[model samples]
Target: MNGESKIKINMKAPLKERKFWDVIVIGGGASGMMAAGTAAKRGKSVLLLEKNSTLGKKLLITGGGRCNVTNNKKDTRTLLSEYKGNDKFLFSAFSKFSVEDTLNFFNSRGVKTKEENEGRIFPASNKAEDIFNVLYKYLGESNVTIQSDSPVVSVTKEKEGEYFVVKVKKGETVFAKACVIATGGVARPETGSTGEGFTWLEKLGHTVIAPDLALIPIALKDKWPKKLSGLTLPDIKITTFLDDIKQEVHKGKILFTHVGLTGPTILNMSRDIGELLKYGSVKMEIDLFPHLDHGALRAQLQRLLVEQSNKKLKNVLSILIPGSVVGPLLELASIDGETFAHSVKTEDRKKLVDQMKSIFLSVKGLLSEDKAVVSSGGVELKEVNFKTMESRVVPQLYLIGDVLNVDRPSGGYSLQLCWTTGFVAGSNC
Candidate 1:
């Protein structure tokens, strides 16, 4: 049948009919689709229900439209290390459906992948649509039934047997021998993640850890951050301090946002700051020249000043730093930008050296959850078996993706979690 014929047939089908499935996967996001495909391929009847008008809404926007499908790291130990909250719980799942398995799963489906810097794997076509298309095609070929705009209201386990009855918004019901909850966390509400999965799981007598924002930018207390917005500095060391004690230090590229600091260095330190913020105020120090010692930085500045003695102090600094930062550096050093380099005092020279080594900034709080890339806290891992992603309390019910309490550094780790857990749940379902 052609596309129009299929649409007519779907529209002609009666609504609110009872259906039975061997495996019913809720939330047609990354994990749900994977679970549905895997279960159907294993000869189990599967039904994939999505709340939105289409599937993979979040997947389409991932990695700025060029989906970072999975991390290239094959070592489970190294991959698990990137996860913060529940790294140990994923041991069995990763062992069964490892990163290598994720790469192979996509490659076999004709979605070619390439490993970028820091082990991030992206589709060679540089389009997230390719990944979504492959998954959609795989689901179709696997005979998985997909229903869009079907929001699950609740899931109740029948006391007599190992079956479940899932109720939808319009009072329609679907019965299944097993159910997999792949509903994502409440990070991107625009993509249909509104924390509904947590509520559903809670109704099923599961304890859910209150979700919190993660992988979001920090808001700074200082006004200078707004001025430096859009400016990016490479090879910078970011140190987080709580009550004058150094808490964590990360070295990478740093980007100045309108509110505070962002980029890889700041993102890696965000979870630490989020944890510390519960206690008291947190301070951050950025070492612009992390590779250079204080003495070496001072000598380098002195040499630049000596070589360009005829130029103004601001002009001399343009060589060491970007032109946009010259004014701010001079302001922090308490030196007039128009002052001649030859006339700079010893005290002012020391201040300039100090500013170049450590640029201080204060963080008030993190950006709102809506701006976060992924959420941190969710269902605690202790309640679920990592090997199958099945709930220990409720048999045959599995949880995967961001709904679980696990957050990792940027570079495709979060998506890998979805793929790994989804693969395991689908295989076991």
Candidate 2:
């Protein structure tokens, strides 16, 4: 039969069945859909349950609604390096379902993708809905049963056999020989990721690391830098320090938020900041002119002053920096903003150059878990069999996606983890 007809047949199948399914995947997000599709393609009976009214609600909003599908990096080691926590645990999963596999998987299913800067991939059509629709279509054609708006309250393991009884909120029970928990973390709660899966896993004798905000914006202790909100500086270097010791140095785009800092560079370093925050306060420094040395920046400022010696100090800096940042830089340099360029002192010129080179911001803390792009903590990696994504403690029970402790950068790595782990679990299940 054609693809359309096959989907119709699969969707028309009744929900009632006397026998247990081979695999019942919970949480119909990215990982759950992939697991269900893979299991169904293997001729194993599969069912997918989602708490949301529809699947891929979060997926629809990823990558600014374009859906970064996967990075173009082919080396498994490089891909694993992007993961901030538990990179070593994903060796087997990446081997089985690497970036190449993701590309081919989507390409074969009629969804084409393209690579952008830093090896990030987006749909060739530039639409996240296209990616979701393709996955949904594949699930429909593969006869994977999807029950939306069914929130699983808890999971009960049978005493006699290697099966699980999933208890839903509305008094529904599903028994399956194999189960995969693909529920995501508590990043975007409006997308139906309420962290319910973490609670369920904790009750089932699994050690769940308390989840925290990872790739979220940092709120500063002081409010002076808040005036620069919405200003984006490219080619900047951000160094995060804890207790006077440098922890991470990231180079990329940095955005000034109403509260503090964000963007690719800030978000990349935020994970380490989150870890350091557990101990004490963290400090961050932004090198606005990363490409220019102190001497070079000083020379540039001097040249600008020479060209505009008669103009007001504020007007002279208006050509070099934004209006909002000019006052702060002047304050940092201890220069009078009302003074003319010719009246500026030599020591003040050096200070202004130094201030422009490195701007300091003290981080009070990260945003709430709901505002986080991805959560850092989840099920500890040691308890999971990375090869098959199955639980070491509970036989035939698999875990994938954000439910694990693995956390990566914001550029498609998190979603790629879902595809890799889901593929491994489904293939083994």
Candidate 3:
């Protein structure tokens, strides 16, 4: 589906006095659209406010536009553990509407989903448009009104009544009995997730945690990484060290970028890297053969040498490492890449094995928030009711999605949180 043609909201709808909607969901992202559609399904008049010309701007780019819908994990605790802060805060929400329910919701709407490795779910068509189409259809069928290009500026609660007044960019005041802040976080600002909801929540007596870039690429201090850009190393383990102390390790595919490192493994550990950077310089080690230890790697290298004794050392090493990364790996080990494999000394083989086992890179910093897949922080979890997603400080106010303080890795966990919180908020609101 064409991205522009989706989200059929009445863009030309004039701003005028109308009956107060039961719920006004600010931000038409994954969570906002879900909340609006679910509330409208429950017979509530809903208005979905989108800052962009279309809804689901961020959603369309999720999972490289295929949109990892949700994970297939049935264990609630295991699922919540993927998140960063206060995993227990989502117990009520996930218990109410889970990953299974998310899959069922889409499947029931004729959008078939399939699970990939690690329980990551994606549309059977491999098109994020399919997921958005399901939501757009739901919004249309539920009679949920949407206002595109209508960015909500501030939300103020009435002193004498239970209603809240939502002020848009043009100073138009839209009244609603309940307000759901689904505006998302600061990640991917081009997608309209600029963390505006954090400011609004802060103004309304909620503690807004300072958001940092999460699930994003990391900038490296070494220039060799730029040469290895575009090469993908699969099943490698990356360990992050904070001032020489090991903090975290992740194993998955890592894609080399012009600036630094990306892919699931690096993005998942980026939050820890961000924190580790604050204290001192951060360093990371890559274990190419994580399934094998040093002695086993040496044995494997020995076997490779015997198998390809006539080949150049670089060519022999290329069997274990990517062709693009082989030259650099040999250089780091101070070994001549052009040396004959059979003539290589045992000490040289050991150095090669050590370098292959623990490739080192000093992390310069993280990419900006706009480059992140999800922001690391949001409204502090203590201020919101996990059961209804309602704000404990402000009655009739609900915060969901990236607006909460939950941060999860890729592989469908983040979107799963969105689905769970969005559904729970919609069910209660």
Q: Which is the leading candidate under TM-score? A: 3
Q: Number of backbone collisions per candidate, in order?
A: 0, 0, 0
Give all candidates' CA lDDT scores.
Answer: 0.84, 0.84, 0.87
TM of each candidate vs. truth: 0.88, 0.85, 0.91
Off by over 4 Å in 1: 1-18, 84-88, 110-117, 124-126, 305-312, 339-347
Query: Measured by C-alpha RMSD in angstroms, how accurate is candidate 2?
Result: 3.9
Off by over 4 Å in 2: 1-19, 84-88, 108-112, 124-126, 241-248, 275-281, 305-319, 322-324, 331-348
Q: 2 or 3, which is superior by TM-score?
A: 3
Which of candidates 1 and 3 is the stronger one according to TM-score? 3
Which predicted model would earn the best lDDT? 3
Q: What TM value does model 2 have?
A: 0.85
Task: Pick the winner on TM-score between candidates 1 and 2.
Answer: 1
Q: In candidate 3, where is summed lDDT lowest over 10 consecutive residues?
A: 3-12
Model 3 regions more than 4 Å off: 1-11, 17-19, 243-248
